[model samples]
Target: MNGAVSPLMQLLSEVETLKKQIAESEDPVLKESVGSTINAIVAYGQEAYSEMTQILDEFETFQKMEGLTEEQRNSLLAQSLDHFKDQMSDHEKDSFAKSCEDEYKGIWESLDGDSQEFLSTARYLGYALRMRGRGNYAPVINEMCRVFENELKKKIYNDYIVQMTQKQVVDMDSNTEPIKTAVSKKKKNKDYFISDTEMVCFIEALPSVKNNQSGYLSELKKYLQAEKWDIQKLSDSQYTKSAHNYIDNYRNDSAHANLMDEKKAEKCDRQTHKIIKHFIESKK
Candidate 1:
């Protein structure tokens, strides 16, 4: 029954509790202040934890020095610990310790009696560096990533999904119809929402599209190569059909009379096809 706790676990518990209390608070001002404080605490806790881990990792790297000794390591640790401590206020430091404690408590509560002793061991390991009073985080950070690359990847992916979900929700509620239309299209055709990074990757994967133009040429080349995409291959009758689709897709002429009178050659996708046909013929 040896009980030990981590600062991170403790901080997280406080945050959860504070969040609950904030939600129930009678005073609006108090609730707002509590929420803001909780946010700052959590933000600082994460940043400090990451920085401390990185510092430890760097110190570990220095351990390889030709004349590195226990005394040297302790001295460096002590100095770095003081520097990190000075970077935060007493309240922030306490918040960080509480976060670790909350994090450890969760793990301990989740375990069965058979492995209860593991809680103390895990907490000891988690808090050992903090107890050591040092801030060489580089080695610890590097080691953690090397050991948990998959976990890191999962975290990154989860974060991206959360962000995109929020963005999509907001886009749906936007007052601007243009933005709403874009959002609807993105929702309908996920591929159309391809991020700039994904688009670049797609273009690079298409080697044949490698004209002097960047990825733009790649996409253009793709369209040119498609069986249904070639303008020259299309008959005059097909052009008329495509022009109608283009106008129907882009032009908002709901009335039949409007469509008849404003035939300023509807253009758009049809015009693009004509331009591409000219280029293709010139090249031939």
Candidate 2:
């Protein structure tokens, strides 16, 4: 193998060259044997590539630990072992953040204007909360909730307006009272943003609107529930109760911040991403 090229890459390259050579050969039996061998080599190369990728991920994690003193690093390592056992190292948190970013970057870029704005902000905050420590995660998580609710409120309100407009124009006589009532209600709440209670109402009202879907809110609820998150509490109002609790109990504590303990931050980070990913997927 070449010194510069990875073993996996070298094997893959050799397999391709062998495949080309076998394609032009006259011996059928030799071709079949060599083709089988190439297939085996390709599979092994794929496994090697996966292993190397994981090693690279770990190395990247290690690089992030460079600035800490030995005692700090040892404490971090000990804490990680307590939470994650031998399977996880100090780099796991960073790895998780990086993996989520890489996996969803393309999908996030493809979102509609409002969705893109909300998700991009959420992702940035989540990354910051996980990777940086300025006691900013509290405010960031709060803002994340606000952004999510604001975007959802806009979507629901616009959808409702479109439905009402169509009904008013098409079925003028029959829908006159309902349209008048809806318009009055909307006009009365001009500055209203959906609170958790209002979000539940909006979701309940979705089935009545033309082109409105049913699965989004339900799926979001299910996802949160499966994660053991407090969905009803999250949806009862705009604030993320769990996130606020963490901020109040841990992040805001004077001693905790200087310790550089990331367990609480990691939890909030993951939950924020989960919420963002679920919202994006539901919209799609």
Prediction 1 global C-alpha lDDT:
0.38
Off by over 4 Å in 1: 1-8, 63-125, 128-284
TM-score of each: 0.26, 0.34
Give the distance in Å from residue 225's predicted Cα in candidate 2 to where it truly belongs. 24
Model 1 C-alpha RMSD to native: 26.3
As a whole number from 0 to 100, the lDDT of residue 188 in candidate 1 is 58
The TM-score of predicted model 2 comes to 0.34
lDDT of 1 by residue, 107-200 (tens): 3232333222222222233354544454432222222111111221232222333333345233222223332343355455532222212222
For model 1, what is the alpha-carbon lDDT of residue 269?
A: 18
lDDT of each: 0.38, 0.43
Q: State model 2's lDDT.
A: 0.43
**Cα miss at 99, model 1 (Å)?**
19
The best candidate by lDDT is: 2
TM-score winner = 2
